[model samples]
Target: MTKSVLVIGGSGGIGSALAQHYAATASVVTVISRQKAPTQNSWHWFEDTLQSPAHSAQCVQLALEQRPEVIFICNGVLHDAAAMPEKTIRQLDTAILMQRLHANVAVPAQYLQLLFSYITKTAGVKVVVLSAKVGSITDNALGGWYSYRMSKAALNMLVKNISIEVRRLNPSAVVVSVHPGTTNTAMSEPFQTNLPPGQLQSAANTAERLAQVVAAVQPEQSGKLLNWDAKALPF
Candidate 1:
């Protein structure tokens, strides 16, 4: 049984569900998010915008002090009131692209960097970053959603790089990117209309599947991108 877990972006639909799922079994559940997470007596909440290096470092330091065995980085942004994903080259905006990059890639990269030493030190540690299959360069047949796609692709590369580096220091560590599938979350709300019926999953269901994936992933699968069912996908 896992003793401790950390869920970044824990206020979001899937993140919150994952935290709650682990909280039932794990003794220590630490969550860091921009907004306050739902009240749970067993959980530790840290409000962090992830905008300042000093602030992020402080939160990560405190959280990692617990030596969480499982870590989930679920920070991502597909759209906002200011802009939706670009459907074509004509709709692409520099500001929007940068926003997506900062949220999807930079923020997670910062946390991974902060958590590096702790991850290497902990035995059998599992680090799962929520990535989208759309990020796969080899799987891009139907192209669009420029900013979101580009940012996720960059995030996947970051995960791959970190996995390789971490493996050298700690062979027991498992760090991989996972595509959580189309879950019923605010991030996927706008696009759910076209999804084939059963493709949309509840937050709880997604969390359960993600937890299973985390449990089953081995050190050999560290650098690959995995689907919801733990199948390896092309990078």
Candidate 2:
């Protein structure tokens, strides 16, 4: 059982479920999000925009004090009320692209940057960044969702790079990007219409599967991108 855990973006659907999952056994659960956490869980919540590095650093410093054994970076955005995914290059807007990048890549990047020192020195730490399978360059058979795809692809690379660096300092550490499948959340509601039957998972189910995957991942698979079933996916 995990003794200590840190969850970023803990107010989101899947993220909140993950916090609840870990809270069952973890003695200390730390969460950072823009909204207040649900009052039911006894997690240590730090509400922040996570836009400024100095602010993010302070939140991370407090989390590290708990000596978390597991960390989840779940910050991401697909479509918002103002913008839907671009279907073609002509439909792409620079503003939408920047918004996707800022949420999917930059925000998580900030937290990872803040946790670098702690990750390098800590042994047996498992870092799981929520990435999408659509991010895979090799898996792009049908092209669409430009902004979301590009942002996730970039996020995958960041996880790969961090895994390599952290391995050299702490070989026991496990850092990998994981695709949490298409959960029944607001983020996926827009795209769920065409998904195959049973493809959409409930937030609780996704959380359970992700917990199992994180628990089973080994140090040797540190730099890989894994599916919800724990299968390694191509980056």
What are the Cα lDDT values of the candidates?
Answer: 0.91, 0.91
> Which residue pairs in model 1 clash with each other?
none
Sequence-dependent TM-score of model 1: 0.97
The sequence of per-residue lDDT tens digits that candidate 2 reaches over residues 1-235 is: 8899899999999999898888876558899998876667578998887567788788889878888999999999999888998889899999999999999998888888889999999889999999999999999998989999999999999999999999999999999999999999999887889899999999999999999998899999998999999999998
lDDT of candidate 1 over 128-226, digit per residue (tens): 999999999999999999999999999999999999999999999999999999999888898888788799999999999999999899999998999
Q: Estimate each model's TM-score.
A: 0.97, 0.96
What's the distance in Å from true for residue 181, model 2?
A: 0.3
Question: Candidate 1: where is the Cα deviation over 4 Å?
Answer: 37-41
